[model samples]
Target: MSNDQAEPETRPCGLTPKGLERQKRILDAARDVFIEQGYDNASINDIMCRAGGSLSTLYRLFGNKLGLFEAMMTQTSNRVFSAFEAVECAIKRQETPEQALKRYGHLMLERVLSPEAVGLYRLVAMDCSSERERIQSLFYEQGPKRINDKLGAYLQSQVEQGNMRIRDTEMAAYQFMEMVKGNFQLRSLMGIEISEAERELAVEQAVELFLYGATCR
Candidate 1:
């Protein structure tokens, strides 16, 4: 299945503008196929057919089915990380912790509960168990872990400035993220649609509670 696969942890490493565009087209098409067919049932040919690209490009760019899926995960991770960077900058600007938390929480919730995200989660749930280690590793290394690292860095900054007291920023990030979601994400992932107002209220309350628990004297 290996064609021109890069290291497990890298992507978009060498794609040119035109190449990136083609790759994106392939990815968008693949996403549709994966969402429609789920992982196991989906195939590169289907993707190629839908993408209007050759198998060579997919193999050359992604390597194989797993690589393609990881690329999908990568896209989602990149989107979230972009948002995290904004939050990081806002926090660095000395925005109120509550305000920053609300912004971050809202963005995170929106991304995780998106239609595409839910579809990916459902696809993985339906059929990625046998390769859980590979898929989970890909997802974690690029998605959750990256966000956690961003959050940990931000929290460490706050702690250094005496804005918060956290023994472990990593754990704090995990706790805060979980608290932000609570049962909301679980319900959303299960096909329960949460309203925008409800999402905002939940995150607002969660951030207040999170700050109360983490704020310094």
Candidate 2:
């Protein structure tokens, strides 16, 4: 479809199992295309070719290329953050705040520093489209913002339990996430190899530092 074409007014919802599977296939193909070719260079036709779906179906499901990218990001973010459910369970079981944070930190590092995640970040970062703002917003809302909100909720729980002292759980969450990431994300985007030992060390240090600051005195 042309860039100027109006996006479909209605998007697919509550699809049958088959339809959902097909949609997943299309989204997976779109993710691969966007990551390999970057946003501007990627095309709907190319994605359809890889996904083996009709052009009309793709448009009906995703609305447009941007819509498809947004869906793909949302799916990917959900997958990555689903692992954090364990952290919540740990908290409910009265695990120490340090243990909970460390679990979150390790999971965050494993997912965020992944090649696919870094590729998606680079795709959004390097996008030069008229819809760049929308793309960036979608990525932030689906990815980083979700991560911060989850971690913030966890931190708030600790504060309520008198395990930590945080005036702004939101900011504290953002800070802790940044600390966990450190230079690894940048290095990954730049194609630098981060060893398993380095990732472990980074998470360990970040959790330690964050707990040191956040713990109730």
Candidate 3:
């Protein structure tokens, strides 16, 4: 293989001077192209033209359209997960499991209701048939799996503290998440309208149902 065809050697963590600027341009262009053209319709030439850069720059930076897509998926997922982690951190530092859980639920609802998340979810669902594994990887890495793991850690902590009765914290965490997200996700997937008032009401009710249980006191 020619030197140009060989894989790029790793550079420093920071991008080289020209690389940084071109990378930003490519990302911005890619986002517009993807949004405008959707998944299958967009082309590398179109993206290159939008970015005003040669095809080589696109290849060197992202490999191809799917690489660019994976980058976009990672970026969007990271933002949501960062929000999740912040809530988890706050919850972990709390005095009680109930408080931690409530805070986490609230943050989760806020994120799910956000436009960025809604758009991303819709996009993933739409592309699932054609890009099954890629979409699944994105969802698994940044969605329910991570959330359940964090919740399980919290539940285990509670168990260790003798604050709750639980045979399996992982199961408990998964159940809690299912209770919390089940309705909203279903509605969102169906394109049903979820007003702000309804979202707040649903979140509060779900949290209450999970912690207090449905059995009469």
Q: Point out where model 3 deviates above 4 Å.
A: 1-14, 128-130, 189-191
Evaluation by lDDT, superior candidate among 1 and 3: 1
Q: Tens digits of per-residue lDDT for model 2 on 153-216? A: 8888989989889999999999989998899898998889999899888888888887775566
TM per candidate: 0.85, 0.91, 0.79
| Model 1: residues with Cα > 4 Å off, grouped in runs | 1-16, 213-217
TM-score of 1: 0.85
What is the TM-score of candidate 3? 0.79
**In order, what lDDT does every prediction score?**
0.77, 0.85, 0.70
RMSD of each: 4.2, 2.5, 3.8
Better of 1 and 3 by TM-score: 1
Error of 2 at 38 (Å): 1.5
Clash pairs for candidate 3: none
Candidate 2 residue spans exceeding 4 A from truth: 1-6, 9-13, 213-217
lDDT of 3 by residue, 9-98 (tens): 442356788888888777777766765666666677887788887876666777666777777666666776666665457544765766
Candidate 2: clashing pairs of residues: none
